[model samples]
Target: MTTRINAVPRAVPAEEVEVPFADCYITTAAQHAALRVLRSGWLTTGREVAAFEAEFAGYVGAGHAVAVSSCTQGIELALRSFGLPRGSLVLTSTMTFCGAVQAIVHAGLQPVLVDVDAGTGMPTPATVRDAVRAYGPPAAMTVVHWAGDLADVPALAEAAGLTLDQIVVDAAHALGTSAGTTPIGSQCAATCFSFYATKNLPLGEGGMVTTNDPERSRWLHQARLHGMTADAWRRYLPGGSWRYDVAEAGLKANMTDLQAAMGRAQLTHLPAWQHRRAQIAARYDTLLAAQPGIALPHRPALGTGTHAWHLYPVRLAPGIDRDEVIAELAQRRVGTSVHFIPVHQLTYFARIASVPPAGMAGADTLFGQLLSLPIHPRLTDGQIDAVCAALADATHRQFTRKGAS
Candidate 1:
């Protein structure tokens, strides 16, 4: 008798799942913290914000953490703190949310878009060198940790022939990420994190900047407000004088006490939440491993660091219409999203930089193939299986249609 083997059956959903591309995980403790802040009668930046800053600083192992209104503001403030000359060129990845480039432009600096590695959708040291060769040396560089995967900042700086102080990190997706015994926030000159609703540590809306430089930390605090010598909490509280003076022009980017309270509560649950995220990612990997025309997200090398798994993005093989697949998943009640369109492809940046479509081949190719799947603490195992089943069915149908045509 001939030996026989059968492929394992893929799990199908018992019923349709209304999976969303992103969802905020809110706990009862977070709700209580928000209520406590509301009952305290102080809503703006105050004691809660201070405590949150300290707690976050300790969590990330940074010497100082400054709470801000958003990650964009944090990036702008960090860049401004460097005091780079007006119209200075800043190097940044094109495969990002565009906020970093926007921050650079808002800070009176020019942005030089660097292409990313196609495999990882993140800029490598080689790409950094290419950008430098094409656009000349930059006054500063902002490295984005795409999809919670940490980039070797030290190596990138070395490739660009710049110092650590000249490097800033846009770690919006990497709050819990680490690099072989070293956390992300403490490595660069300034590392900025987001607490946007869809982020790993959701606070609805908030951001933080971590730095070891005391002077820069102090400057960020003053600059987040009105560049005043003293904030309202300092001057209006008990034994606080009404005396203050303007130091410099600053933007109002302070995080409110309400957001800080929720952040503090959410921070406590981050480790567990991160664990769930990993579990979801692993499930996705196992379910999609045998599916043709689908490539799972790239993972960093073992012992390199831990991934935060903020977004479970996968790439579709060429000749498949990504939009059609997205529509099919939507019809099946499985929501999906594209991570980003290359910033260099945006009209404004394209006009300013005058880069052709073929200039950044890596980012361009990745953009066409990328699709973000649902990955959060709130997702159930069944929902993950449903997502994979829907995706496999959608791609198989596309392949069938192509062959028929």
Candidate 2:
């Protein structure tokens, strides 16, 4: 008679150390394309760049897409394309990256900051109108897609009573995002996208400027390469003219062929990657909602568009210090981060709004409560479970019985 074998019970392996957030989804296709770019002798501003630009332009539903060095540069170029007068009033949300502020300043425009919605972290259309009215006629309004959530850009543009020339979108966080039926890049005069390593669709460090105006598009193409009338390759190529003209002092901000190769590969897989992002976001919503003090982000009821889900920032209970919460979470080996510290809260914005820390209630309050958990696509089910459990423990640790630590 054969003895039946019994399986021995084993430890659950300590949940595999939970998970780390923000894994870049580079595929085999990307690797192959990168290798191909290396093999191809002509690397800088080659056919790869054109192919990637065209593909991206089509994807974003824009007439032109100018690949640049970084999103910040794209924003600057967008502003500069208008050829705005120095000190022209420009309005943007106060709750934004420092790059937006710098873009305005660098373009020789005066930034007139406006407050964002307390809950949504977006500038309301009314606020845009009011800011423009108060600050005098704005040369342009740069609406950021905060947290990969598209602001009410079309409505804000409409309220300004200005042409599309007056609308530029700092869509650094909005690659595969859309506002209503139109994609994020299609709604404004110029739309800038970042491919920073941490960004949703990363290309190490690169950016794109999509626009409808042919003149603006041409200017951007030239501007990214020392304002040269022709590309360097064209100038140096066999049977090419030695002479060229530099009309303006343009910034050196061109995307290399290698970066374009990576971008092209990323773009091919962006749809699928974004699909996983949405799935992860939904999972966060379901699991995190059970925590009593956590507040979730709200999508517009009327908008029929895809949220890129680049960030999954949840607001913690008021009165609970966010730093303490983060520290406790870190002690539990949970990876967490904050979206931003508002622009006005920085020392530089003191001149624009001398609002005290307490008075800048909207931003200060939000900063103290927001926490971004691990929501990357690489997360496994068990890891996700562990993170949720860790969060619960942290929350309970912070808010339990008489608010004892």
TM-score of each: 0.95, 0.91
Clashes of each: 0, 0
Worst ten-residue run, lDDT, model 2? 1-10
lDDT for each residue of candidate 2 in 335-370, tens digit (9 for 90 to 100): 888878788877887575323232445666677778
Off by over 4 Å in 2: 1-16, 352-359, 401-405
The residue-level lDDT of candidate 1 at 112 comes to: 86
Alpha carbon lDDT of residue 219, candidate 1?
Answer: 95
Using TM-score as the measure, the top candidate is 1
